[model samples]
Target: MRLSFTTISIFLSLIRAPGVVSQTGLAPKQFLNLPLGEVKPAGWLHDQLMVQTNGLAGHEHDFYDYVAETDWTGGSSYYSNLEEAGSYWFNGMVPNGVLANDATIQSQTQYFLDYVLDHQDSTGWLGPEVNTTKPRYLWGRYPFFFGAIQMVEANSSLAGRVVPALHTFVKLANTMLHNNGEGLEDWTNTRWEDFVMTLQWCLYDFYPDGNEELLLDTMQLLKSYGDPWEEVFKEEYFPKTAVENLTNPFPFLTWHGVNMAEGLKALPATYRFTHNQSDLDAASLGWDLLFQYHGRPSGIFAADEYLAGLEAARGTELCLVVETMFSGSYLYQVIGDPKFADRVERVAYNALPATLTGDMWSRQYLQQQNQIAAKNMNPDPFPTDGSYSNVFGLEPNYPCCTVNHPQGYPKFISNAFVTSPDKTSLVHVYLGPFSTQTTLADGNQVTVTVDTLYPFSDTLTTTIEAAGAFTYRVRIPSWVANGTISVNGAQAEAVSPSNGLHSVSVAAGTTTIVLNLPAEITLEPRPHGSVAVHRGPLHYAFDIARTQKVLAQNAQEARAVDLEFDATVPWQYALDTSSLRFQYSPPASGVLPSPVYDSGLPPMSISATACQIDWSVAGDTFASPPPTSPECTGPTTNITLWPFGATKLRIGEFPTVNLTA
Candidate 1:
């Protein structure tokens, strides 16, 4: 039996599930994400987002063929015979346009949404799949719904239409799954967590009493039919070595880079339903092992296409970086671990932007920690990538990163803050220049404004305005020691963080709190006896001078071009770890410059003494792994290092040279 729209609304209001806990012992999420548009970017973070809006991301539909003429928007063709490219664009564009409040972007997104919703099939299937006899692929719908739900949440005016449509689709999906799990294959099967996540949202947030059991059963069927990520994460089944070294016919899905990134949260997502202790333990074990062997200093694992090992020169895909950030964000919310949030910041601040051009007009399909050149490689280091894999341009080597990269920072902003399970407090999950307005459980209206250049600047000034008393919590990154928080100019107290978060009992009215997270120069030992420099959330890299060569350009957008870069200055260096010093230069204008990711724009840097070392490039394109031990080959000179995200060409991992020896 189907419930009418009025009955569905009544049920939703009456049984709005507080959290994803059940009598069957499903695990409860520690935190719940604030609805889209509630958290908005501010200060330098907003500037960075504006850069995205002005660059390729904001203009894709106007020029890029895949998005401009894709079937998702009533165009005549599917992108590469699949709905993925357009769906990816929709996923990123929805949040970006909503958060930026850009009229053009909003109009573009609305146009696409209108088309898809207006043309839904009689069988409740979304998009143009109804007209084709080709096998339906469920993978693309995961991203489409992810974006659709956000659009509905941000613009509630669309709710009456969008919500009921989504329910109809879910009912059809249940029927399809029951009929031998049709349409779930390959990518969709491996990434079933994405589908499960959307279902969980529908079940917990908008479930109708009549179809409650159907939704739950569909989730179970999808899990059963999908790739066994939880089982693959087991010690015996997990691949400890690189994919290249694995025996024939190894679990290819687990070794795939993007799959690994998206799969990281599979067990944790599953634990919510099963509540099995093994699922939780396995999730933790898989995370530890994934990073322990294949991880890079940038907080991503090597996977040009598959899992590469811990060499500094190995490439990490752009898709992996953003997916990893999402997984990290999801894990933090589900498991309530501060480390997950920490890792998300690492990838977002360093790896995500590092792959994209400063203006966000172009991007690299793959990025290396020790990258010194951005040209086509003759003998590419990647196991399966092409020669142009590392080139910084539009759709270099592949188009997935092109369409998918836009979601990185915007979603990061969307999840910057979350409400506690009981909704008594608002938790700042990730530190950034953003503000949030959320209503607490007791009907207290709370508005929080954070003003600071975090990751670049360690000081965060938080102003909380509330209608009544409530607890305010902020995450103290795992790297922070000797951090202090002062309330309303009171004497600063040492921040005593429990489980990576510090709580303050704040009374109603306007309260101002200041957080001083002073960071020290820390060195991480790399695989080749080299050290990677870090200060707070930013990873420092030597800013190598480079020359750009434009290979192709779009007539529609002057800034959109396929480009290659070659280092003009020597990049082989061995640092004197003892000589590392952190420096901060506040912007004179009291505001960060637009396009802040450009070289030399960040207000903070590191100075260190280093000398040219005997290092070589692989295939005359990629930087070879740093030497295990290196002796100086040139006179020592002081070098300035900027944030990894700031430079187009850099050496983030440096070998050490002993001058005394």
Candidate 2:
């Protein structure tokens, strides 16, 4: 049922995760995964997104006050309501501009600094321990660690705040490593969330002068305490101890979505920072094992409160997708390969959007494939209370997702544009405007000014400057609008795609790559069971209000119309060159409908009217046979499929319909 793929042959020839190849022995030119940011979209959007989150969230102290005031803890009220409010605010501060002389950032960030300084003990430790002797908040170390690492990435001045916090982390590590008198469990009354968070934060700070002994100690302790990631990849990772942990699935592959994912996402980053090759390699291998057991096409491994089979109605929690993206970013840095970045992009583009509303507000607990509308009970054999896309306000159905989710947007901004070990930098994504500077390889300095209207348009440009000669390799995205290169201003002829990169050689000179994303909105069906509608990197969905098709079907069963919206007559036929579309439509003899997002999945509760997908069906012509019954007909139509994760009601896996007419 799976289309065999070769190892990815694209991206710079960096050390990516091991390859998955096709029967042809060809690897994929690009590994479609998460943390996708082309400098064009990633740079600007990262900056803008940062601005949005921090602006909405307030400084940590302010946000802390707001959430604390609500007195909500570890429940839906906290997860959905308080957590999301926190996320929206945090999103505003992620990218470059958000911190570019922004007064709010300067002030609010300072407040957190003041809080840490005010609390530092004589030993340099920052926060109070979570025990009868000292418990600052109702939670453990995880959230605080995530917040602190994020704050460090936001700005260096904020970094000054980290030292004191490290002290506190070291003390906590001391307890866990030593197993001092219920010391570790005392943090959250034995809850592992705090312990895991504490461990991850320590990992982030692994460097010279770091608590190295403590880190090794905690890693051993974590191994013993059933870190699920450790267990799932035990044989693959700790072949030494596979006999011990892999024998049981308790902590090896538990299906609960949020907790285990959070740990996987963070633990690897820690190992990456310390040059713990064995740990990093083990962690990545474990991720592969996890993917084998529970990966979604969206690039997130499943988290359905437990592992659900691949096509099952229950799968990955929105929270798991976000966490996976965060973790993948670190994998990118550690492995220095664009493959990890590709995975990040896949999840970011597909799964992230599915979790939240179009406007970047609200998210879901679980995201399903046979996602049914919230209004009814199991109408399909596969139906479950779980939904495809859910959007509610603040903390929607669960607060853990809400609280955990907020960290993603801002953190995403930080990793969007990355530098090479040699100081070469790239504008990985397109969203808004921003700037960054890096020390390039060969001891040279370079700064980039990026401009684009990405995910909206494909055309974008990046200008680089350095005093000396250097070769900066820019990425040519697989879904590029259209690619061309210009040295300074002179356009270069297209060269053969080398390792998936179109190398534009510039000898100690400035250059520009004119990127054009396809402006045309196109649709492609899949072999398994869905279709994708695309306009550049931004996948288009259907307008429920005007759409005539709503059933989720395969290429054979479904169809789409080329739509052109008119100011006067909106749903009027826009006409494609071909004379075909889907089978089921306005029953009898009416127009076939388009897939819409109004299924009312409770976890997300997304507003039906906001940001109507730019498309709606205006016609349908069968290219193949229709299903026997309305409920279970498979798609018989033959059509090119848009990428999975781009749109709802599209085929991710497909079947051939081979119709000539």
Best by lDDT, which number?
1
lDDT of 2 by residue, 182-293 (tens): 3333223223433444444434333224555454445444433433344445553322211211233333333345555555544344343334456566667766666665
lDDT for each residue of candidate 1 in 1-661, tens digit (9 for 90 to 100): 2235575455434432233443452467889898899999999899899999998899888878788844344545556333688788888999999899899998988887777777788998876653456787778878878888898789778878887787788888878877777887778778888888887765445545466666666667677766667656767656666677665232357578998899987888787777777877888788878888888777778888988888877889998998888888888888887878998898889888888888899999999888888888877787788888989888898888888988999999999999889999889988989999989987999999999988778899999999999998999998886999999999999999989889999998999999999888898888768888998888899988999999988877788898888889888889888888889998877788778887898899999888998898777787887887887888989999899998888998888976545
> lDDT scores for all predictions?
0.83, 0.41
Per-model TM-score on C-alpha atoms: 0.94, 0.62
Task: List ranges where model 1 is wrong by over 4 Å.
Answer: 1-26, 69-76, 80-82, 130-132, 248-251
Clashes of each: 0, 109
lDDT of 1 at 85: 83
Assess candidate 2 and give its lDDT. Answer: 0.41
Q: Candidate 1 lDDT (Cα, whole model)?
A: 0.83
